[model samples]
Target: MAGEQTGVGIADPALEAAAAPLLDKLVADGVAGKLAAQDPTLWGSDAEAEASIRLSWTTLHKSSRPLIGEIEALRTQLRSEGIDRVVLAGMGGSSLAPEVIAATEGVALTVLDTTDPGQVADALAGDLQRTVVVVSSKSGTTVETDSHRRIFAAAFREAGIDPARRLVVVTDPGSPLAELGEAEGYRKVFLADPHVGGRYSALTAFGLVPAGLAGADVARLLDQAALVADAIAADSADNPALRLAAALGAAHADGAEKVVLADTGSGIAGLGDWAEQLIAESTGKQGTGLLPVVVENKDAPGFADAGSDATPVAIGPATGAAKIAVAGPLGAQFLLWETAVAVAGRLLGINPFDQPDVEAAKKAARSLLDNPDALRGTAEPSAVIGAVEVYASAGTTGEGTLADVLREFLATAPEGGYLAVQAYLDRLDDASASLLRSELAPRAGVQTTFGWGPRFLHSTGQYHKGGHPNGIFLQLTGAADDDLDVPDRPYSLGTLQLAQALGDGQVLAEHGRPVLRLHLTDRAAGLAELMRAVQELAR
Candidate 1:
């Protein structure tokens, strides 16, 4: 097995050294022990482990290579068959990875990640007669994926396309998806190894995106990932992922409350979401651990240019602070951030994995589907009903003091409900409109809104950019002095430049949006601020 190895020359001795205490703490706290025991196969002989990891990673990369060939093939096939847009259908890990690949390679791809009827409706709005449907699911039983499969399959019949000619299935060999493909006589079928989880499968059949669309240098990508696997397998604590786990444990022990994972681009954004699930599912438990908080770069015109005038700028201050540390893979700084979040969760005595709340929300949503009228109520039954008066505080103070005030305010407010706007009067047109439209909008009382994940800014970008700009923007910002160098650009220089060009700070300032800026020298302070803000908002 390939053990962890460091990349040649690119290895950071200082980083390894700095992470020593954290690694030691992780080993001491039983986290290292748990992982070691859970997956000893991964830590076996370095060569073997490296080979295994590389095989999987490279497979994904290699899959894309054949994709270029496949693309030419697809183009010819499509041209002869008179097919136009290709619809790739999947959700979560299956869709996110491919979506990233397509976005990065500039392949125009449409993804179906949600079960919302409207989204599905839009995806099928095009010329189904000339469209090819690609249905992907590692498990093959994912309710949403299967639901979409049924929907598309029906649509295929409705459009008069032979199901055999237009449908493609990508899944594990013995999985239901594969079975369905065979039974339905789909023309193309791709199989992923069942051993790989949805997130990890990206490098396998799950990542055969380039092949599916006929774009990208899959071979080179595979080689690079294989090299990374080799390096990781050979190294010890110096291994980026392992070192990250160690850092997370240490930060948690240091009283950090949450892990803030961030990235600069869509590729990294998807990866961050994957990391969130990994940590949340793997380690989140026992009531005393750091929570994972994922952050993404906001979208704006001139976002690609780090130094462009219209780029968004990072506020000098860190807002929405938390105490838990952040870390991710070293090769990719974004990965480093993710790993840091895991490490911080461990240190904080919280599981970095597992999201019970998500399940609860899903359950609630499912129940709502059974009784559509149940959604009519704007407020929870227990919610207190009343009119609210707005008040604004001018002075800013430390978290401890602010938290106390917030707690007092919450206690004094009528138990029924109250909306606490940070400012007495700020543009709230956005919220008001949303309340009138969005099904999930809060009633008269309290609602929490903020931009965290980077991708959401894309969907909501228009509203934030050119729209009425009526929302209360509780902008959260953070900075770490320890910067990584970008492979193509000067590390986060692109990110920094984009931030400035968007005039992100100016957006809030000029719009007169209520803004709260928290400054922190490190991850811990940032998390603290975030928690305080959340609490204040809740209050």
Candidate 2:
């Protein structure tokens, strides 16, 4: 039912009944009020210190008000200069929200969040004079972002255009990116609130800058969130956040750990993709957590049926259809999910503020980049299946085609474990790759997740390496038709991308998770062959 005050609807008698006691207990404990007050103690003493700073996300709707005018002014100035094309070069949290915001508003914003050489090349091929690159990095030193910034700068210079006038920087204050913005004379350097974590900074400059420049009414977005901000913090029977948290907690306790989300005419676009990260990264730690499975549509997965361990969730206004439904304006939706994930964190006994397992892959990537030669030692494909070179990372699988490797590796997947297809390919040029997840679902008979490269490393990567360790990994890499070289780095974009995939694969294999690395000799042909193999396997 839609909340008269918050405009968010959550209706499911089953979920409400199962979670009623938990919700009552939460209200009695004043979880919502404590969260609203930014009381770090709500998550217990162990998480207090971290939660203290992370709670700033709760205040962003108000604190971020000033950014609206500034962003609007930038957009006006860009438009005046005929610089209408906006290309966002960011990763993970810094990129996902803006992508959703722009898409929901039906605006055109080119998101360059991948290192796929073909993708980067395509982005570079855009009208340079009309392009304004928004480089966002919460850490300021993210390699993919740095590479993007460097390449774009070089491209600008080659076109006799001034990067200082075209590039916009969004980073934490006093960070390297901020410093670079100043030194390079970027058009604008928007500093984000330091207190807000990357994933939780959707309303911060990290999200606002890109979407605002891309012509989204970001101020209205803040207003929408503000409408529910107060209601979200109230500990009452009607509190959507608390109810959502309780529902997830209760479902997990009921042995339904996989939360499958489907969009049933929500009007809000890509909410699942954005929420996927928040849920996966926040609670996915300490070896016990909720795994959010984002389906392309309501009918894409079979989670709604009986006897399934998966909890079906609808992201729309309809009631009594799914076990739970979260409906609100895009802004309210973002905050609702964030708050629910935080509360769910406390329920699951983990610090949602920290991502301890995310660092392992980063360190592994850095190490691999230090010595490119050793990166190829384990990369020898076990078999050449047409356009794909398949490398069995889980141990020596009997030599066979790509389908055979998938069958063997998937069979090794624990009874409840899922299949994660990671594609480090150009999202735009190779958009067909996203369909692989849905296609593999019927064939594999397991929950499927498709992550587009390095971005997922920052989101679900924590869960894969830290959460339940029940993930079966399938990594897809493609040969860059044409590669772009980073100006100052010894490696090309292709090298960095390969290192990322190899590094994650190495780490997953080390952690005892089986990873089947498939290299696409010909991206288009390989994707077709791989999809064909999956369809054939289903027969």
TM-score of model 1 vs. true structure = 0.54
For candidate 1, lDDT tens digit of each residue in 1-539?
Answer: 01122211112243345557776655455443333223323223432342243223323333445544554566577758777667777755576566655555556667765433334566778888777777888778765566667777777877777777887778877987788789878977877666455544555656554234535444444554545543233235555555655544544444332344433322322444444444444344444433333333322111212121111211111122211122222223222333344445445444332233333323443454444354333222111111111122223221234344344333333322112122111112112211211111122132222322222222222223232223333332223343322223222322322232123334434544333333222334444443543344431
Largest lDDT belongs to which candidate? 2
Q: Largest TM-score belongs to which candidate?
A: 2
What are the per-residue Cα lDDT tens digits for candidate 2 across 1-539? Answer: 22223433446566667888888999999999999888999778988898888889998899999999999999999899899999999998999999999999999999988888888888899999999999999989999999999999999999999999999999998999999899988999999998888889899999889999999999888988898888889989788898889999888888777888888777887888888889999988888888888887766754444135578888885533477877878888888889999999988888988898898898988898888788756556778988899777656573776677777777877777788999998888889999988888777777888899987997889989888878889999999868888998988989889999988988988889988888999999999998887877752
Q: Which residue segments of model 2 deviate by more than 4 Å?
A: 1-12, 305-307, 319-321, 395-398
Clash count per candidate:
88, 0
List the lowest-lDDT window of 10 residues for candidate 1.
308-317
- For model 1, what is the error of residue 435's alpha carbon versus the real structure, in angstroms, after optimal superposition? 14
